[model samples]
Target: MSKIKQFFVRNKKKILIGLGVFLGLLLVAFAIFFLNRERLLQYAVKKVVQKVENRYPADLQIGKAQFKGLATVLVTDISFVPENQPKLLQIDTVEATVSVRSLFLGRLVFKQFDVANGDVTAFKQDSVDNFSFLYKKKATGEEEKTKDAKEKSNYGTILNRLIETAFENVPDGVNFRNLGVIFQNNGRTISMRLPTLTVEDGQIQGRMAITTDSITNTMYVNGVIDPDEYLLAAKMYAEKAGGIQVPYIQQKFGATMRFDTLSLSITDKVFKNDQLTITGESSAHGLVLNHPKIADEDVFVKNGALKYVITLGNHYYSLDTLSEVRVNKAVFYPQLTYETRPNRKIGVKIDSPNIPANDLFESMPPGLFDTFQGMRANGSFKYHMDFYVDMAKVDSLTFNSDLDGQNLEITQFGEQDLRKINREFEHTVYENGKPTRTFLVGPSNPNFTPYNQISNYLKNAILTAEDPRFFTHKGFHEGAFRHSLITNIKEGSFVRGGSTVAMQLVKNVYLTRKKTITRKVEEALIVWLIENLNLSTKQRMYEVYLNIIEWGPNIYGVKEGAQFYFSKRPSELTLEESMFMASIVPKPKQYRTYFNQYGELRAYPRYFFNLISGNMLKRGLISPSEHASVSSYVNLNGRAGNFIMAKPDTTQIMDTLQLAPIDLLDF
Candidate 1:
């Protein structure tokens, strides 16, 4: 061996001892770091909360943390304060048992989360509230910028990933005790006492009790929920509580309604990326209602209970369509479905037998049922409403009703009273209540003309178009009323009045123009009075009706209608011109749109002209021979036979240059 090699071999043991000391010092440093990990975590969590406060609508305060070992931690005094609210949530302490294996694997996993003594408050003051944080719409450009920042931010991603993994991995226990919630809305306060809440494995269980105005109830929610949703799964059970009274709905109609029971159960689970696929069954009972104003009206729903299932996916929820709601012996089913994808479709259906009209009408405003107050509505009815859309394009909508009120009798206003109101015509008239806006309607007015002064063809057309049974019936025409109601219900809007001449006269002369329940009721009562009390002669009523009716914009009465559409005497209007005039009476203002720039009738007006003409022929208002002549030459002649006039609609000829005289029948 060389001398250099021999000298190094002797000192090798000393060099090894120096390296061992260095490694031991490094181990001691590591032990110190492990022991103080909880403090470091606490600082980190506080800093993160401060950073999040800038983006979140609420404020968060983290508490001091202490570690039992490397994995177990106890945090004290945590709180959340919403914007404009101080301390919306307060937590006294939280002890968390964690997974050591997950820590070694660089994953945060909670074995258990035990929360003790916490209070949460939710208040909605107008549009601002404690829970509003969930609904806060981020300012423009903020969300996009945040997403971009998150993608590039490493520290933020690490912190969030760790926190999310702690809950997402299905914590062994999610339990709470003495957690309370206080809610206030619209000048009313509601308190809910949550006694015990527990979630273990896949089971969710909770119990709560509440007491409020007109309601005192205890609710229990027990179900199995998705385990991965450790944070939100517990709250699903809270949704079952019901039987709360709404002051607005009650006061608006002067009625009190009880919900009985409404318990929402969420079942099924889709934990992928925290998506929820909730479906469950629930039961409801009671639902009694009463109105103080309506005489002896009470909806005593005896053991009225209902059971239904609900499902939620995407962003919307729907109740089972086949579920039946029972009230006493009557069984009624209500169905509602809403979905949005490439399109939106909503469907609603309700059907029942012998649903007392009074039971429904009592809790509702009197205006909607004023006309039927004295009549008994018997039989069955079905209501259907639906709207559809596809590929972001609108589709045809359908809303229809089938009301069968069999054997209805309005004994109060019978034919006896009807014959009496058909007698007074020599003077002015006004609606009984609305004395303001006095409509001076007398023959002395240029547009005022008696039935005798009107053209025979016009009279025939009026009777045929408005009421075929006008001469025979009293004030009510059930067939017309039924058809009008069906049409209005189906369209989901009011387009025509199922009113008789007497009803129309009463509405125009006596009631306010505003459409309301009160006005409608008044109109019904007055129409009954006009017909039953012999308020006016039928001929006189028809004459006054022609004088006061709105024919077009700024055009009132058939006299103005005559001169406005055809600058000629009302007696000189030909069959074609009169039919044209009648076609526009229902929607005169909109009918004006029918006249294009060329002073020619539009398609709808032209169609109505032909249809009414055909109807007039069918009714024998004009002889078949006369109808042929009227139909041949009159393609809606604009004003003059020559189609002549210097300016647009300066003057109009009656389209009656050479008309064959028809057989005139006197009333």
Candidate 2:
């Protein structure tokens, strides 16, 4: 012990000197770090801000940064709030943490992160406006309060801030923990309520998440949210206006609408239910308040009130309201069932009987329904729908509803907020008048009209012109097809089509109308399947045919042709108007010149129309006296002025079985 002590005493001076040097080096390093800390953090934050600006091009600023270790960096209060900006939005707070491992490497490696609290406020002046996060720079002398007030009140500012924090270019190969969001806008609020949020690359996952109730002030979504899986659900709603309704019917249906472009996707997990059920409804305003069957009854109300109650066996729930109706506040009750691998059955139900119909209608935004004429109706109805799902997709959905069928008094939800309504109406009018109208018509028409009326006209006209043997055949009319096929083979160039109406429907719906044997086989197979299933009749075949048939440049359907050629309704066509419309059935443009100059074609197709009508008369398709009168009235170039008709063709005529496509195209 004495010898060791003597050795230690001898080396004490050397050890002291070494220790002193080490302490000096440590002090120097810390001093250098502290002094340059501002610049270092400035460079980093500036670079990040610049990147975000380049992408989003917005007003962005990062709070002063603090570092604890060589690796741990914290940005305390970052914001992307804009001032004097019309387009850009703002956010409240954004916090970021750098991973400890990649400190000196000059690359972002985020292993753990905490985004404690944030708020987003978004706004747009109108539905037609595109949401922009960048604001225009304005004069500096602008009123400070006005500028600040605009920024503060602007919800877009909050949106921008939240986007930067949540979606900034995070480093690869890093883990995340506990990310959350809480936002509110009047009647609605969203709490991302993620107890744990993990993210790596493009993959994101969350646990114990909840989406609060939008209408009845309840939480609609509560469970683990896998961005990848829940994304699909989000996508379904994103594309469609009304996402999904749980309860079949209530006082009013609740739904969300998208008037602008937005995209969302699932990240990692899927939507599931320990016990699951879904209900949905789609009703137009006319169906709700103006159907002829219920039009005359008490519809408009000075005092609008609605109420509903449901009793599922023993459980019961009730809803009440006293005003206009919004289309989404219905409740959904799920009956959940389970099954084992081989063959087992288990059933479960989630039920809600109390749905407030009046409350739903009253919750509608001002001016949703601006005005009404003698409309009065207020009552509550209840409906139930159950879904049977095996694994994922629905197996069956059974819907049942009891419409209270009460005398309802209807009135505008909002007093004549005419300014908004007029603006919308004017925009729609301008859009319809634009050259874009041609785009709407397209090569095939999407004309909105009853399917039955158009079908009857096209069928009779086709049979009057083409083949009379359309209905008796399977996919092909054996006698007519054989005869036409022989003639086409002899001619070397195709002059006629033996295609039946069924074949035409098949070709139009399932396959392209290519004049080739391969396409023909496909068309035939589709036709065979449609016929074999016995799903459609000859009249239905014609309806489908006219819907997809090309009538002219950017025109389709018999109704469209009737309007385009005659400027009249299909039912209002006179005998000559009918014949003139039918004359072009073979080739719409081939005979368009006949009517382009007010029915001026004094030549070929008209002569054929008369011949075909004459043959039909001989075949008892039309009365002789009627045929004689129609023939006498024919002025191939005749104007159908003041030609009011008695009745449109009916289904009985469609079922006559003699009219065929061959007869229509033959002439």
Choose the strongest candidate by TM-score. Answer: 1
Write one digit per residue (lDDT tens) for candidate 2, span 1-667. Answer: 6998998899999989999999999899777866775566666566767766766635676655667566466666556644453333332333345653233333344554555444344444443222343332233565865664555433334333433344444443233233445444343454554444445444445443435554221112211223222222111111233323222122223322221111233232211221111111222221122212222222222221222221111111112121122334444444444454333333333344544435434433222221221222255434343323233222222222222222333333333221221111111111222332221212233463444455343455565565466666555565455445344444555666667766765544443333444356445544543454344566556544555455555566666667765676666666666666665665665543443234333445446557666766666666777677764233422223233222322213221112233533332
lDDT of each: 0.56, 0.43
- Work out the TM-score per prediction: 0.43, 0.32
| Consecutive 10-residue window with the lowest summed lDDT within model 1 | 656-665
Off by over 4 Å in 2: 1-39, 50-57, 68-70, 86-95, 99-111, 122-168, 172-196, 200-203, 207-467, 471-611, 614-663
In candidate 1, stretches whose alpha carbon ends up further than 4 angstroms from where it belongs are 1-57, 67-72, 83-85, 101-109, 135-171, 211-216, 228-261, 268-280, 289-617, 620-667
Q: What 10-residue stretch in candidate 2 is worst by lDDT?
A: 421-430
C-alpha positional error of residue 76 in candidate 2 after TM-score superposition, expressed in Å? 3.0
Task: Estimate, for each residue in 1-667, the C-alpha lDDT of model 1 and write its tens digit.
Answer: 9988887799889878989999999889668768756555665566657665876778888667677665677878988887777568898988888664444444445788888898887788797677645423345597866754443323223323443554455567778888888788866777777788777876778777765554545656565645344323222222333344434446468777655454444333333332233334444344445564432244444345454544444433455665666644445667666666535666666666555543433333223334333443333323333333232333234444344333333345321233322443332333333433334566445556778988877776766666656666676665565455444445557655666666677766644455554455456555644554455667777777777777665567777777766786789899877877665555565544555456566555555555556767777676778766754223333332233222343333222111101111121
How many clashes (backbone N, Cα, C below 3 Å) per candidate?
A: 18, 74
